[model samples]
Target: MLPALALAVAVTVTAPPAAHARTGPAPSAAKASKTAKFPPGFLWGVATSGFQGEGSFPDSNWTRYVKRKATGISDPYEKSVDFLHRYPGDIKLARNLGANVFRTSIEWARIEPRPGVRDPKAIAYYDDLIRRIRAAGMRPMITLDHWVYPGWVADQGAWDNPKTQADWLRNARFIVDRYKHQGVIWITFNEASAYMYKELTMRPMDLGQLAAMRTAIVKTHRAAYDMIHKIDPGAPVSTNVAYGTALNGIFDAALFNEVTDKIDFIGIDYYYGANAENLTAGYALTGEFWKIDPEPEGLYYVLKSYQRRLPKLPVYVVENGMSTDNGKPRPDGYTRSDHLRDHIYWIQRAMADGVKMIGYNYWSLTDNYEWGSYRPRFGLYTVDALTDPSLARRPTDAVATYRSIIANRGVPSGYVPVRRPGWCSVEDPVATCFGTTPTPPAAYRIPAR
Candidate 1:
């Protein structure tokens, strides 16, 4: 599996360029009011994960994958941004940015290193981290699993084993019981389909093995949701879906639909969007990290589509941000601040149209190990963990912009987008090809679909 994936990655690098743009009708002006506002008590935050940000890694599947010979020419995962030791300072940076929520994963590998054996020291570490988040005037948004698990669990056939599910619930129940009083939002799993894809691609998993893993994940999520509410009745629980442009409908049918009723709210992590003309997102599929095109307005279409699909549940942008090549400016000259403001404009646009949107968390507070490489920087503050010895967190252009956005609740009323809506956006093709006039208060379906 590893060698095959390596060859696939090699093909992407050598393959001829894909058609990333298309000619279409002239771009249309967004129909949102200039003074649109988000709903009251909306969450504004930044997100990070343990394996990506935290330096010290436990012996989990990802570490083994990285160490494997077939990975070929990837950067060594050296103390990734050192979030484990520097979280206090980093949390302070987030607080100073005027963010009201800070998202991080409580790594299952660290908390329960061995089956039925809890790590008191690891538990205490989270205790302090959660308190620091609240002390800094920010609410904690904890993710139970962010694609990493205990090494022991991995040895037991991963999700394919019945014991894996039992072990997962045991750990999840303990987490619910321990952190119920924190008054936090819960994420059962992050990017479920993405996780499955990675697992199947890198590990030697047959179709049956893949099916078993996915089934176990959904079962674990449903059980976790019930357990969380049993501890905190008012707690909102969800497993964030990574909304793929033109592919979300399939993603929803495959994994998201089963847990819809179990989820209290919908969590979406949308980063890249494609259209008839622009397929720069093709780069993402082929491992071309530098070839992304930003389409902030596409976020509006994503929120609206989900809002229509799940009218009763509120939606939160659990993770959204732009990535640049190795912390450098884009050749297109789009800045980080520009991406943030433009995306927020669409969020407000969706809200004004009655999408029941509630929250937005930037992809990360500081750049860390982006899965296999640190080259795709997606942080309000850039940290060069690979080269910089001090690992200093340097503020970027987005910091001041985010600070003001949070302080004002959103962008100013008269603010127009940095870029206009793209033509026939595949993010929501039916809506974009037709029109985006706000749906009536009594109705929230995509128009002309």
Candidate 2:
């Protein structure tokens, strides 16, 4: 299976760049205001993941994936951002920037390292993390799953087996019961559909394997949703799904239709590019990440698509930022400041068009693993994990710019975003703003008469 997956990874890595690329805690932070009028409630937060940012945890599937030769991720999962120890430092950094919410995930693999045994130490770690959230005056948004699972569970049956859903429910119930008092945002799963296919596509899976994965994902999400509400009836639960280009949205729809009745809110994650060929209902998307370049106008199109369908629920720029291979200025002498400023301009335009929008969370405060390498840097505070020894976090030009945006409540009227907004490629990839280059839709074919 892994050898075949290695071949798949080789294929994707070799493919043309199409498109690419959440959280923790309240130091304590929801509704964003409407156009011109901010919502009655607004959520301002930064996001992280336990497996990605938390260091010093025991081995899990991702840990193995990172270490494996085919997976290609470096550094072997040691002391990632040292957030396990220095989250306070990062949380403090977010607080200083005027953020009102901190988002992070609970690693099930860590919380339930062994099948039946719960880790007391892991529970304590999260207890401390939640307490810190309340202390920081930020609301906590806890994600139940963020694409990492226990190595043991993987051994038993990943999503391909029926038992995985039951196992997941056990863990979900434990989490909701344990953290009920946090009054936090409950995210049942983070980009489940996206991860499932990406993982399978990463390895190669037959239709039967694909069917099992899809079935298990929907069932698992539904089970977890019920568990969250059953344990804490009032807790608002949602699933944060990746709302990417056509390909990503199609993959993210698994839980949307199957478990629509089980959620309080649907969290949609939107990143770079402006193509709207494949949005699904019941699951509203949060602009996960957007930049001024490569696809600045794509951000505008993203909000516009939501306005057309998800107009009532305010949009949250859940994640958005830029990545420089070498921390250099943007192509047009655009600094990080230009990138953010430009994206905000389209955000304002979206607001004018009556998009119920709320908060905007930066992609990250510091750079970590870009899945495989340190080359793809995306943080307001840059970490030299690849080149710098101190692992120190340093601010970029956008740090001050973001502080100003949070303080001012919006970008200035005269402030020009780095680029102009462009048309959305609903059924065409090459029809995008930055995508003026014509590439036919992947699924294009003539229908029978």
lDDT, candidates in the order shown: 0.78, 0.63
* Residue 106 local lDDT, model 1: 92
Q: How many clashes in each candidate?
A: 4, 34
- The 10-residue segment with the lowest total lDDT in model 1: 440-449
Report the lDDT tens digits of candidate 1 across residue range 1-449: 34234323322322231222322332233443633676567788999999999977878878777777223227778699999999999999999988888999999898988878888988898889999999998889999999888888889889989888888888888887888787788998898867776776666577677667767887888888888898878988998998776555545543577788998888999887877657777666655556777777788767777777688999999999988889888776778998899888888877876778778899889998877788889989999988899999999999999999988889987666666555578865555566543324233111111
lDDT of 2 by residue, 1-449 (tens): 34323323423312232232100110000112122423445676677778777777676767767667333444555776677787778888888888787778899898988889889988898899988887988888888888888988878867777788888888888888888867688887777655664455443456567666666777777777777777787877777656555444444444554565666654656555533432321121211122223445456556665445444454666667777765665445656776676666667766665666766667777776655456566888888775666778899988898888777767765443344333434323333423432222332121000
What is the TM-score (0 to 1) of candidate 1?
0.89
Question: Cα deviation in Å at residue 120, candidate 1?
Answer: 2.1
Off by over 4 Å in 1: 1-35, 69-73, 434-449
Q: Which segments of model 2 are wrong by more than 4 Å?
A: 1-40, 72-75, 201-204, 274-292, 310-312, 427-449
